[model samples]
Each structure stands twice: as structure tokens, then as C-alpha cells.
Target: MATQQTSAAGDAHGGTDTSPERWVVGVDGSPGARAALVWALAAAARAGARLELVSTYPADFYWTDPYLLDTVRLDEIRADTAGLVRAALAEARRDPALAAVPGAAEVPTDVVVGGGAAAAQLVEQAQGAQRLVVGSRGRSGVRSTLLGSVALHCVAHAPCPVVVVHPGAVQPPPRVVVGIDDTDVSREALREAAEEARRLGAELEVVAACPLEVVWSNIYSVVAPPAEETRARARERAEIVVAEVLGADAPVRLRVEDGEPAEALPRVAAGAVLLVVGSRSRSRIAGMLLGSVALHCVVHAPCPVMVVHPQPARAAGRPAADPAAAAAR
Candidate 1:
């Protein structure tokens, strides 16, 4: 049985309470979702956490299909979907990597079918789960613009940390990379990333994309340039940020580069088990339009990315600071 524990309230978005024994994953038969299923099974085995394969048929999937009026056919489709989910579990059982992990065979698997949006269902189940994993479409700039909608929503709203995996990601005991800045949000991002690294017995790499010197600023045409010592001090400050915010003793390698965050992050992300960053909070007006960097990474990294936001500190309390407020400075 999946271990029973009280989950954080944010768990309404698939964030579940995690201990040594409880883990849950949302799955569908999509290649990406199947990959997530396998990943979850392997993680469950290694951590001795219970696993659940949640498959949802969102109302939208049927919006364009009129055959649903045929009850018999609808029933058949549901049965077929259930079979596919079962097959995925069986495949996980046969995987060599899963078998090699200690106590994997003892891991329990569950299949749940829900009627709602995929993001909503997944997040609901995430309550009480240690972490949530999903597969990505592997799209990037220009050619495919935005992240897959489901992934975007899940990352933005998940109650617990979410892992959006890519095909053929490296197995566990891997390095974790987090994009850090001087903001409190980055501190929260670093803390979460460090905790994950510790749990996985992985190394942690902290990276920051420092702004280049304002050589061409219209108002600074006559201003003196920063000294080498000034730049060095900024880098040191970044390292100190990581050291102070983590609140735990863990070795970290810090890197500071000059470039845009969107560009710099991928360079660090290459070949890492996970890349974590904080979500840019949006204003009520802007929110009507789109999210920021955190939303973008949800769909497109070489590896899984965990987008951390400062969860409201109290249950049912207003957020302590504006997500935009954190980003402005």
C-alpha cells in the first residue's frame, strides 16, 4: 500500500507528502509518459517508496471526438487504456535497470483512472508523494515555441517538486544543477535543489548568469567601469548566497558566467540529472498573458528541470511577496 501521511496543502496540485516510503507518479501511455513511468518505478525501487501510475483522460481529449456518444465504444476505449497502463507496469518489472536497484521488486504499483484535466489529476495525486515526474516533448526555441501546456501547468502549479524527464536521461546518483541569483527566490531554489541532491547522493552545481558590464547604457556613457575586484566580490556573494540559504552542509561548486539566463542555463544543464530554478512571479495583469522563465523550462531542457517557487509560508495565507517583486531586484 502507498504509505499514508499528511501532505502539505499545496498538494492540491499533485504535491504529496514524501517520506522514506511514499512516492507517486502520474502516467499515460504516451512515450514521454511511459518514460516517466519507468523512471518512477526505478526511483520507487531505489527509495523503497510506493508507486502509483495515474492515467487521466482529460475532457479536452474528447472535445474533438464525437464517437463518445457510443457507450460501448467508450467502454472499450477505457478498457484498452487500462490495459496499456498495466503493460507499462509489467515492462517496468522486466527492466534490467529496475531489477538491479535494491528492493525494487518489493515496490508496489497502482493504477488509477481519473476524469479531469491531466494537470489537475496529476497534482491531486501528488499530495503525499515525494516527487512527481513527467516526460517532455523535447521541443526548443523557434521551431516549437511554448512548452507543452500540460507540462507548463504542472510545473507552475505542482504542490511538490516536479521532475519533467526527457528520453534516455541518466539514472540516479547523478549531478543536480540549479540556476541561482541574488534574490530570495533563488535562495529557495537553491535550498530545494540541495535537498534533492542530498537525497539522491548526487553532487550539486550552482550556476549564476551575471549581467555583463553596462558598457553601452545610455545613462552610464560616462560612468566608470567596475573594478576586477568588484566583479570578484559579486561572484563571492553568489557563493555566499548558496552557502547561507541551503541551511545544510553540502559541498557545492559555483559558476558565474556572462550571458542571458535562458542561454546560460542550458550550457550548465547538459548531461546533468536535473536542472532546477525558481519561477518568475507574474503580476495579475501580466498573468492574464503568460508566465516567465520557469514556465519556459518546463517544456524544453536536455534533462528534467525542477522549477521551484516560494510556496506561500502559511496554509490559506496570502503569498508573503510578489513573485514579480522578488524578480524586480
Candidate 2:
């Protein structure tokens, strides 16, 4: 039995009292999910949030014919699924990776069974959660998460911020690395980084990548200005935007690298607790999904990556950001 007390919510996405302070984690008996569960335990502990471990089985992975749908077989699968959840939770309790989080053993947890595909079920559960954490790859392990369909789907569609934990990730470092840009999304990223830093009692470092503008493939004039000057401007922009979004009093380290964001971000994330970045938008349109940089981090960063979603226009409180001023050109 899962030590975490649970009650069937009936509805696929239902919960008795869904709270914003909840961190939802998708668990399977896979090595990746177990690693994700361990990371989420510490993260929720840091954020002072409730932890919910949800295990899902293919609700339709049964017979279609009424006569062929053996009730006993279905019952056995449910029982086995429940036991897997229990064992995963138990192992997480004993994981030394959570030692950084005091009272790790005492963090109240809720175990749930979702009846649907793993990605859809987890996304449904994340609707009311403060954040969603998932493993980059699952049990099959044949494909790198860079191309993992389920991880990609959740990254592009989950309602809340999604933290993708690489199975090979080590314990989170004491610093948070955020990719800085001049856009509204980047400002939002800085804000999230600030909050995460405070929550984890860690230092925050801002990194901006400024690639030299290229005129034409046939022209090799380096766009007039040298790359160093662009990098310098990148440093200045990071300082200004971070101060504006996080307040002048915020203490954040800034690094301006002379490369594209896709290259710079993962370089800085080598040993960081979390890599933070913002997606362009989450429209259903194919081209409007995760930005190139954000996707790269999600797929390759050795540490866990946190992709901050843009708040809706009517989300309240914060005034509209001037994209011209906030975004990098």
C-alpha cells in the first residue's frame, strides 16, 4: 500500500481540494520517474508546497468486448499499479538525494491513479498544480528525451511550469541559472528565478547569449560591430532587465556569452540546481510551441530545467511589460 493516503477522485482530473501549493509528479516504475520523484520531493519542500505523486495506467489498455474485459484482470492491474506507487514512494523516502531537504520524511504526500495516457493524465493533473515535474524519458529508455514524445508533449502543453529532470542529474547545486533576454517572456523568467532562488535559499545567476548578427551568407563583414561589443551590450541588457523585473535590490550574477542561447544556457547549467527559461507562447499551432533555446535545455541540460510559461494577459496584478524594452533584439 502506498504510505501516502489516497482516495479515488472518480473524474480523471478531479481532486477533493486542488491547491496551488501542490507539486504534481508523474510516477511510473521506471528509473527516470523515480529520479524525478526524488527531485520533486526536495523542490516541493523548498517551495513549502504539498506533493502529489500520480501513477497512471492506460485506461484503455484493456479488452473492448464486454465479455472479453475480465474484471479480475483489470482488478489485478490496478492492485499492481497501486503497489508500484507504494514502492516508489517508499524508495524516495529513503533516497539520500533528498537529504538537503529537512523533514523530507515528514512531507505530506498524496498518491493518485489516473486513467489515461501518461502525458494527458499528468497534464490534466497539473492544471491546478503550482508546478509539474516529470522525467525526461520513461521505462523504454531506447530514445533520448531530446526526442521523447511524452516529455515533449508535456513541455509544450502542461498548464503550469514544468521541470524536466534528466535521469542522470545529480543533486541540485546551490545556484539557479536563468537565460536572460529582453522580451516580456525573459522578464517573467527572471521573476520566476528570483522566486525560486528565494525558495531554495540559493544564489541566482543571469546568462545572456548575444550572437553576432549575420548580414547574408555571401557577406562576411560580421554585421559591422564586433562580437565583443554585442556581448558587452548583452551584459548591460541583462543587468537592466533583471533589475527591473527583480527589483534593484535583487542580488544576481550576470554573464554575457558570445553565442546563441541554445549553446550558452546548457554550458552554465552544468552543475546548477535548475535552468530557467521562457517559452515564446503555448498556442496550439506547431510553430508556436517551445522556443528553440527552451527546448534545448529541456532535452540536454544535465540539471533539472524549469520552463516558465507566460502569464495570460488578464492574469492580474503585474502591469503589462513593454516587449520593446524587456526583450533582447
Considering every candidate listed, which one attains the maximal TM-score?
2
lDDT of 1 by residue, 1-329 (tens): 11222222112224432435555566666667766766676666555566666766545555577786565765565566566667777766677767666665556665666556676777778875657777664212222443345565567666666777766456445788898888867777776676656555567788877665556666774465565554576678886786566532446777876766766786667778778988756332323325356655554567778777565452124222222322232
Give every collision pair in model 2: 182-326, 182-327, 182-328, 183-326, 183-327
**Residue 29 lDDT in candidate 1:** 60
Best by lDDT: 2
Residue 156 CA displacement from its true place in model 1, Å:
2.1
lDDT of 2 by residue, 1-329 (tens): 21223733221234444334888888888888888888887777666667778887766645565642776765666667777886788888789878768856655677777556877778888886778988888876766434436677788888888888875544444788899888887887777777777777667888988887767664566447676777787788888887777666566778887678988898888878888989875865434444578888887788888888786542346543333322221
> Counting only residues 3 or more apart in sequence or on different chains, how many pairs clash (N, Cα, C under 3 Å) in candidate 2?
5
TM-score (C-alpha, index-matched) for candidate 2 = 0.84
Q: lDDT of candidate 1?
A: 0.62
> Which stretches of candidate 2 lie above 4 Å from their native place?
1-20, 65-73, 167-173, 213-223, 285-291, 313-315, 318-329
Error of 1 at 236 (Å): 2.2
Compute the lDDT of residue 298 as modeled in candidate 2.
Answer: 84
